[model samples]
Target: MSALWTIFRRDLTLLLFGAPGRGGALLPLLFFLAVAMLYPFAVGPDAKLLARTGAGVIWVAALLAAILPLDRLVEPDLEAGFFDQWALRGIAEEGVLSLRILAHWLSFGVPLMLAAPLAAGLLNLDGAQLWTVELGLLLGTPGLAAIGVTIAALTAGLRAGAALGGLLAIPLAVPLLIFGAGSLQPGGEGGLLLLAASSLAALAIAPFAAGGAIRAGRE
Candidate 1:
């Protein structure tokens, strides 16, 4: 219990504030904002068009922001022999990764949810649409975090793993993107339900898959 708590705290700190060679929540937050800010300039000042497309834009920005932290998630720890140390101490990799998924969501997902309102405004979303966007993100970001950690573990020791992680994650996250953005539509409650199901499925599988990847990498 103590060791898991310690590791959780460590992962959360590294993810939120960053380490020497790793990115933190700030970079993703800034990148998300940048995309939201730039969209208006690119498409010109059409409020209806912005409002119509804004929720989807927010979904896309959140997805991209989720990717920014992939390089730092598991690779840095693997390179530092942190996983080996945990294994030597009799801590299960699955346990550690389960905690890591929580930490990753806290660092990556929550901030994106918090920032969604600002993105909503930039994209000219209405009050109702903003509410829906928030709800969709709440359900969807967990899956994004799970997928990010899983891919990070899978591609940890590979060449250009960061880029590969992005490629892998984008395809896997497509369901979340589709459902998340689709939920913003007026009769889209079904999309939200599907989004929740996808998130739960990812969360259920991520810990075991990521643990196996880490163990394989050590062999």
Candidate 2:
């Protein structure tokens, strides 16, 4: 229990504050905001158009933002032998990975939600649209986080793993994107339920999948 707490705290700090070569939490937030800011200009100043497309744009931005930290999520620690050390101490990779999913979500998911209001304004989303977008992000980002960690673990030992991880994550994330954006439409509340289910499913599978990948990497 104590070791798990320590691992969680360490991961949270590294993910939130970043290390010398890593971009940390700030990078994703900036990228997400940049997408929001540039989108208005790219699509012109038609308020209705912005409002109409803004929620989907936000969902896309959040998805991309979730991708930014994938390279650092598992590879760094794996390279540094932390996984081995934890194994020596009888720690299960699944438990560590589950905590890492939570930590990853905290590092980017929560921040995206917090920043959604600003993004909403930039994209000309009304209050009701903003609310739905926020709700969608809440239910969907965990799935993004889970997918991110799973990809990170799967590619941790590969050449150009980061690029490959991003490529893999996009297709896998389409379900979340579909449901997340779908939730913004009128009579689309069912999308939220689907989104939540997707997120929970990812959460359930990520730890075991990532753990197996890590174990395979060790052999």
Candidate 3:
């Protein structure tokens, strides 16, 4: 537990606060809000419409927001040779990626879930649907992080890699979003359960792929 927190704090501080001028701090948060806000405008001002759409809107926004930071993840650390030092610590690179992703989820995904109320308000989501949205996010965001991390590592070198990461992520994540968004609809609890199952499955599989990608990036 202490080791986990240490890794979490170290990765978080390095990515966010540890930078010289606080460069990346606001980018993730603003990206989150902006993506959430787009729904009402795009779908019109009808409350019912917003409520129905809000769940999907927020889920997609959360996903995009969650993914945005991943592009920068290994770039700086790899450039500075953190992985070289990390490699000698008797821990596999996958273990390192797992720690970092968990911390990133805590810093990024948890707040996205916490701020879901803003999306609810904007979209006028009812109580049950709001709960559905929340539950879906609770389960789904970790999947998003796991999958997003893998894709981020894969695209670490290309110029448009970050954008491509998001693109690749969308297809892989479509099912989660479908179930997550559907969960907010009437009689959609089944979908949330499916979403939870899906997320768990993703978590199980994604790390190995991400670990492989990270190793390739290192070499």
Candidate 4:
């Protein structure tokens, strides 16, 4: 228990503040905000269009932001032999991965939610729309975190793991994107339910799958 807490603390700090070569939480936050800021310009000053499509833009930005940290998620630790060290100390890879997922969410997911208001303003979303976007992100970003970690683990040993991880994550994340953005529509409250279900399913499956990937990498 103590070791896990320590591990969690270490992970949260590294992910939040970043390491020497890693960009950490700030990269995703800035990227998300940048997308929001630039989107209005790209499409011109069409207020109606911005309001109508803003939520979906936010969802897309969040998805891209989630991808930014994938290379750092597992590869750094795996390359440093941290997984083997934890295993030698009787820690299960699944357990480490589970905590890592939580830590990863805290690092990027929570910040994105907090920053959503600012993003909403930039994209011209209304109060109600902003609320829905927040809720959708709350339910959806965990799934993104799980997917990111899983993909990171799977591709950690590959030559172009970072690029491949991004490709893999985008397709897998389509359901979340659909349901998340769909929730912004008038009759789309049900999308929130599906979003939560997808997030939970990913949360449930990611640890074991990522753990197995780690073990496979060792062999």
Query: Per-residue lDDT tens digits of candidate 4, residues 151-212?
Result: 99999979999999999999999999999999999999999999999999999999999999
User: Residue 149: error of model 1 in Å?
Assistant: 0.2
Which residue ranges in model 4 land beyond 4 Å of their true spot? Answer: none
List model 3 lDDT by residue over 1-219, tens digit each: 665466667887765553663345456767877877777788788887776677778877877787677667766666667776767775677877887778667767777777888778877888777777788889888888777777876887778887888788888888888888888777778997898888888888776887788777766
3-92 per-residue lDDT for model 2 (tens digits) = 999999999999999989987899999999999999989989899999999999999999999999999999989999999999999999
Model 3 residue runs over 4 Å out of place are: 1-5, 15-25
Candidate 4 versus truth, CA RMSD in Å, comes to 0.7
Worst 10 residues of 3 by lDDT: 17-26
1 against 3, candidate with superior TM-score: 1
**Reference-based lDDT, each prediction:** 0.93, 0.96, 0.76, 0.96
- Ranking according to TM-score, highest score first: 2, 4, 1, 3
Off by over 4 Å in 1: none
Residue 175 miss distance in model 2 (angstroms): 0.3
TM-score of candidate 1 versus the correct structure, residues matched by position: 0.98
- Location of the lowest summed lDDT over 10 successive residues in candidate 1: 16-25
Model 4 error, position 217 (Å): 0.8
**lDDT (0-100) at residue 145 of candidate 1?**
93
Error of 4 at 182 (Å): 0.2
